[model samples]
Target: MAILITAKNLKKSYGKGKNTVHALGPIDFTVVEGSFTIILGKSGSGKSTLLNLLSGLDSPTDGTLVVAGESLNKLKSGKLAKYRAKIGLIFQFYNLLPNLSTLENVMISSWLKGISVSKQDATSLLKQFGLEHRINSNIKTLSGGEKQRVAICRSLINKPAILFCDEPTGALDTANGQIVKDILVKLNKEGMTIVMVTHNEEFIPMADKIITMKDGIIESMNTQISK
Candidate 1:
């Protein structure tokens, strides 16, 4: 498989000098095209930081990050937005607008990107996640799982080459988490590359490879047997 995302000795820090804190890396990694890769770590283990760096939501303090052949270090803010449109990111929190309906929430980015998509197609994708009935419903009324599903829908609105998920199931109950996992699996089968950060042990069995991190470094990268 071709490499869709690559990192070379990637490093990040907070503050400077005496106040500086090394958050993650000086680590090297890659995500292959159409693969499902998981990064696992406990709280404060830099899982979210690494995801943010990879997704270009945060800049690295040192080293290099390349996604889908674009060098993040070389791109300016405007170009970064265009580059980011090809790489979808889903946060632990749904991050939906309170006044927007679920369908409208999913369509926001696409609208900004100037994609000519209809409400009909947006309705269809949300319905695929069993959210059709709630299409016109305000985001504030949805459950945690439902909100996350809307986030997933929003992430896919642009049909990105790679999807970066930060603790995707962190707020969901077990059943809903499993449902989200299944949705990810289905997306993977359809040839979408998925790189997820999670502490949930249940996700381990679903990963093609599990990479563990601790103390701002990668501890191990293990390939998993099929369940």
Candidate 2:
């Protein structure tokens, strides 16, 4: 598989000198195309910081991050915004607008991108995730799992080249987390490159590659045979 992402001595920090907080790397890693890769760690391990940088939500303080041939640290705000639109993002929080219906939440980004997608196009994606019945449901009415699934649908709205998930199943129960995991696994089988950050170790057997972090640096990296 082709390398979809590469981070060379990538680092992120806050404050300076004595007050500085070393949140993340100086870590080097690569994400293979169409692979389900996990950044696993305990709390305060810098996994989320890495995800933010990789997803273009934040810039690295040092080193280099190249995703899909674009050097993220080199892109200005305008160019970064454009680049972000092509990348999918799913958060632990659903981040859906409460005033909007489920379908509206899914289509909002597409509309913002000026993409001409009909309702059926959006509906089909929701339906594929067993959300057809809740197509018009309000965001506030949904459960955690339902909201995450809707968030997943919204992430797919733009047909992103790579998907970045920040603790995607972090807030869900075991069953719901498994459901989300299965969905991601299925999507990976269909060739969507996914990078997720999590503290959960239960997903070890499900990963194509696992990047473990401790105290803002790589603790270990392991590649497993596809499950």
Best by TM-score: 2
Model 1 steric clash pairs: none
lDDT per residue as tens, model 1, 9-115: 89999998899999998889888898889999887888788988778787788888999999886667788878777778888886788888898899986987778
Off by over 4 Å in 1: 225-227
> TM-score for every candidate vs. truth?
0.95, 0.96
- After best superposition, candidate 1 residue 157: deviation in angstroms? 1.4
lDDT of 2 by residue, 62-89 (tens): 9999999899988888888878888999
lDDT of 2: 0.91
Candidate 2 weakest lDDT stretch, 10 residues = 198-207
What is the lDDT for 83 in model 2? 80
Error of 2 at 151 (Å): 0.3
Tell me each candidate's RMSD, in Å, in order: 1.4, 1.2
